[model samples]
Target: MIRIFKQLLMTTLSIGLLASIVGAQGQQTVEAASDSTQATIRVDKVDNLSSDFIMGADTSTMISEENSGVKYYDFDGKQSDLLTILNNNGVNYVRVRVWNNPYNEKGQGYGAGNADLINAIKIGQRATKLGMKVLIDFHYSDFWVDPGRQVPPKAWQNDTVDQKAQAIYDFTSNSLKTLRDAGVDVGMVQVGNETTTSGICGVTGNDEYKLFAKGTQAVRDVDKNILIALHFTNPDKTTTMLNYAKGMAKNKIDYDVFATSYYPYWHGSLDNLTYVLKTIANTYDKKVMVAETSYPYTLDDTDGETNVVKTTDDIKPAGYPATAQGQAHALRDVINAVANVGPKALGVFYWEPAWTTVGGTDRAANLPIWEKYGSGWASSAVIGYDPTVTTSTYGGSQWDNQALFDAKGHALQSLHTFKAVYTGVNEQLPDPMLSDDEATIASLLKNPSFEETKMSDYQLTGSIKLAQDTPKTGKNALNFYGDTDYSADASQTITLDAGTYTFSPSIQGGDTNASSDLAIYATINGQTKSVKVAPLTGWKKWLKPELTFSIAKQASVKLGIKIKSNAKSWGTTDDWILTKIANSDTDQSGSSSSQASKTSEQSASSESDTLASSMVSTKSTKNDVSSSKRDKTLPRTGEKVMIGFGLVGIVMLASVCVIYFKHQAS
Candidate 1:
């Protein structure tokens, strides 16, 4: 009877261990099937359309004195209105600046095209009639408002903080009301121009918030439909810009858009602009727009005015030459970067693209008025100006080289780039070497192979190196290692639509003695699921590990690669590719069979039990062991634990026999 009881115990333990293994495999199979079903449902609903991206230009001086004789011409040299040419080239919006009063005390115009309210109204009317949207920029000063100078309006310079706030509110309301009454379709309004000095009203801290709040309220009162924008300079100044937005939120200053000026020379590279735009759009939940941007079409000056951006220091961004083609490429890249920031990127407006060198004067038309009231601000405003020079012979526009039109008033190639619709897929920049399929793939990731010196898209942790000696394909591969458990990892966040995707990477262990275990972890919907890659045996060859999965909704997924154990060397990975699986590869009827095959592969190896144990041990070490302790009332599934239990069962059975024998002796 004791022998029979021992046999029964052994059978029960074996059956329980097999059941646990089968159960775990079944759970994985069910999850894969569910993901496939969700993907199929989502793929049927994908939509492809042109993104609602804004293509605009700031033509503040278009109707001013300096542009009095300007005329735009097409490639064929046919003369036309500047607005007509822009509209024909697919410009959908126009931005005009409004100063409090550009004229001097004696009523003589400051001669910089007289950017007053009346002229701004005329520009707005023209844009509206041409079926283009208008953005009213309120400088809220008699002259310019920039980082160096944000002087209050000449009439309000002596007012207190409270009084200034009230004046801003009244000025904003009255200006917007006048534009609306004049039948200008004011789609958006900028509250202040480069309000980075102190605040919009030249005050600090909460007082600035008060000014912004009042200005925003004034616009809303005039027309709630018009979007309100707060403008600043330098996209690379992320901390300053973000803090301003945060302060506005804390004080309940409601605005719809956050705008910035990004001249590559002053602000940084296109990549820097992209990062700033993405950060602001994600953090503030507000639409982002490049209110001002420009590039030179030629290095040669067409006028006598000293060119501000002619020096090497002023042409900072690499790869963009001071030529017509380079200008087109640079502008295209900027627009593409903004569009890639998702739907929150409304659009970009080229600053004063039509402010040409046509009617420029050798000297100020009203020198006495400029000196007395404006303090000779216009002459000094030109780039590369020498203060010691007395004569105002600053011939033509300093920004003529940066304009969309040449001196002959012919439209440059850059103007045509704006007509290309932003599809949010392949960018408009020229890449002659890329094939059709290569272009499609390249559009998915900017740095796919980790060959680029700057790893802008990836974040690395632990011991990481870019190995070149034994790469799989390219000249470089990512090597990650650490002596601590699961310390080596690389991750990147990507925005993807709901669909099936395949992640394939060429991998190899450093040597036979290295930790060969690798796993790909994908965090989606706040939960992490991991797929194991085959352990590498040697560094002689590379193995391709592929994982196919699906997402149910559009989200930013964090894809990571990690080593599972501690060793002298972890491994190397190269030619990593993650792309959406073609629909033809996924058949609804074959999904179940595919899942079954995957389950079989997972359990086919003799080391399957060891893998299970490793997973369980890692979890126990990281989390509370008591939370998932095995059920002692049932048979144990772990190999070592089960063997010990079997021995105990036999010992108990032997004790039972001994007790029976002792009773017989009695």
Candidate 2:
């Protein structure tokens, strides 16, 4: 009887084990399935932290929460303006951008862009006055922030890296203090608009870490405890993002939270955000926030102009209105999507919610930062029309339409939806991830393009034969004949060793209209010089530019050539020349005989000069290919080559002369 009972128990145990396996597999399959749908999202287990983010909504719904409900007294309108309702419901923060020097030299203040310190102060003051937490966003530039086109502010040019970093730090700390001084309680301060990704400060291809570290350090030094968020534009590559964070941490840099800018129009739907947030938060063990986010309310252009029109197709969901009601719904939905990510999800900041219609006040209109493609403007401001009574021929009040409150500052019916979203009590919507089964959402968090492939050393050779264009590589490479134009093909490396060399692409004055001239230039030590080449025809082996430049004994240099066409139009011929030669011999250009006789004398003199002079340019600076060391002396705009000699060749020849004199004494 005991043996029989044991057999039955074994059978029961086997069935139970099989059921557990099947259940686990089913859950995985369900998640995989949701992956196939656009709205389906997935969550990765990074931490056991509960993700209970506030899903506050922003409502630009025109006039009162129940504006539509009260139609002919059909229903009572909801109380409050959309934004206020969201704030009351649970929204924790609001972000706004401030532009610097938006006014032209004329001082005739441009529109809302002049959110100079004074303007920013007012906005912060108003937001705090309403008891809402304000976030100060420094655009770094007077415009937008993104991967492409993050030109530093114009005035900051010529400043050293330290100077620039300090400037940013001062601007941030001071601005934050200013807001606080004005009785405006600023909860967060974004050091730079969006630098969470790779291109933070050190000028992309250069010492990115060094430069960014300085700024990041500077900001922290100002207020160690303030929540410092590193904002990134892409969420897909958690590894890449983590790599950057690790690099910073290795250097002992500290930041409180990680933030990202995600727009479904560009990033994708709900699933993408959830995966990015959870993965990055768990990986880095830091808080996460959607620092800057937005969506168009309608497909219609308020001004009735097709060019300025916003389209749902530009994003998705095809029929979203350009109307107030449409915008309010879209706003509410996005907030809910972010909140569902869980615990580390602090909240979302609606960018420029009060960007109202003020004449000449469009940020993207006059500011190149906001302009996309053509000049018509890609106005992303929420407030669609003007609240002020002032009128303009350009439909000045267009932006005021997106404002949460009506023209009279009265609450709109859409406010009810915003409040519902924030309270988190509306409904426990089914997990967007639970419905997903496919894992495609993983793609959204992919890394930005990385050149993981190793590079190989190789030589690229070609010539600017008489009429053909020869591309120039290094600043020291020579141009042959009378050709001066050269294009740098995508991949080629020209290396220069310490020595004196001459390079010049010349041209014979043919048709008086065809008076073309060629000049070669070189950057050595820390200076550049150019020299005229004796004009010659194709491969005129006879004309050797008498170039004699002394490259510091252990220094490297780059070569370039400037082509001149005295014709009605410059560069009409479209041809260039390239040549490279390394001269390690200390001999003068006079040849072998000269070298043997003067070697010793030249050596002694060079020793003297080297001892007396501090390491000139190339002063132990690393020559990383990605670096951009602006020769402060390099003409801001390309300087016109005179006769045929440019600054580069002249400097090279002068150095050669100095070395020649030393050779004579030896």
Candidate 3:
């Protein structure tokens, strides 16, 4: 009875201590959650003068949005002129992208503002009238050009490198002359839009430098006073993009400002951004700036078009919430980072803050207007210009949620982010969102998260396996990589009752180009719908992509991932989920909210199960006295705590046995 009482007392003490530790840990988590809202402007105007900092916005689609019947409003909620509102909020520079041609032979518009020289001049005139300097971004293509696609203008498709260079010079000189003739104050000219991947004017390699030089020459000849800028994207791959500048410097390419696109989520750390820009400024003796950057203020889809940022899981990737203040925090930090780069830094520009919905808020109502006004992402009219744009999968803005204005055009609080940073606008923002990774929903696919030791439920083909190198979550992820040209595919077929569902998976790493085609697809009833995963700049960069589909009746659906790449290309996909959302016609497990609760419970249960398993294993090892039984590598607290308790219990047992034996001997 005495020994049993002593044993029970020790056990109770151990339990109390462990419970205290756990409670303390839980309290700390809650405190951290609440403190996330205490965000302040980490860097102040100490980096540069307010007057010198260039607060700019890329209002490329403003004209199209306005023409589509968007009304502007001031902070006071009074309807006001857009330019006046921008100027009032301290925006001193405007950027407008100009394409060589955005229409077919029939003169039908290709959308994205139809920003030819005429519309660009008109937009520039508005900003210029408001005393704001303009940065003319020449895409040098007939349509939108980026790392993904850089098609040459139709008129220059047959031109050689030399011919294209001459065409560039002539086109630029004429465009600048026209802008000057229109009384627009042009402060800078971006020679190419995101030319980091390849060449301009449909050329690649060394020829790209030659074409860029001609564009720079044209800018100089037209107006030496105007700052000439070369723009690139993906500062995360600092080595690669820095090499672009080094290549230009090696080739004697004359340019003033070296600009980069900085999306907080897509790009790497801001410290890296500062380091790269600082190196370029000091090494090449050129000014640096963020040519384009923007963050979503909300995840709510204001327009009928799906938002670029669709999930709440995406909002805090950069450590900011999807609130108005969160947008401000992101923008301010980008400015602070640029300013932190020292005086050689020019400024930062918010991209397309005003590209809201056209016509009315409804998607159906906006379609005809988008078609009529060329206000959507890509109109059916662009099918003639861009072969990639199909009659379907076109129209509606993917950027409405990222706009600095709400869908109704009222300026978001983030609009003042520019002025606030310049004037040392230091204020506390709401804490960042608290997220639950253990979140899960009912799904048919086993080992859906790739958490299982083996690829049990998933069907694999060609170099497909679970990888430990890098995962978005957990210790393992589904990886696709190869040294030679290859097509790798992985799939899981599940039978489901009649229902509509959305499949979301996070994809990371790749060549940042589309030639290989990395995608997640779902096939139901002999019909397949696939969403292309963009090849990001680096492995560390991640994107949450979703694909939605519905079945009229119960059927089998094959959900999978496919990757086609040339030599030495790679990417990863993880955290698979297929959940039934609300629809007018459907049979689902439960409402989205109920499923969310269940998923939360499942996540928590999984965590609890792991904890319980560890504890049981620890308890089972109390009598494990063999030398090999002890694992010297103790990484978790429970095991260490249990070991300490075991030692104490053993010491007490030895004392009791010694006393009892001594009494018997006496």
All models: lDDT?
A: 0.64, 0.42, 0.74
Candidate 2 has its poorest 10 consecutive residues by lDDT at 443-452
- After superposition, the stretches of candidate 2 with alpha carbons farther than 4 Å from their true spots are 1-90, 110-112, 196-202, 236-252, 304-309, 317-333, 356-414, 422-666
lDDT by residue (166-201, candidate 3, tens digit) is: 999999999999999999999999999998664676
What's model 3's lDDT at 106?
A: 84
lDDT score of residue 142 within candidate 1:
70
Give residue 382's error in model 3 in angstroms.
Answer: 0.7
State the lDDT of candidate 1 residue by residue for 490-514, as single tens digits. Answer: 7777988877666666676643244
Instruction: In model 3, state the lDDT of residue 269.
Output: 65
Estimated TM-score for each candidate:
0.54, 0.45, 0.64
Question: What local lDDT does model 1 show for residue 623?
Answer: 31
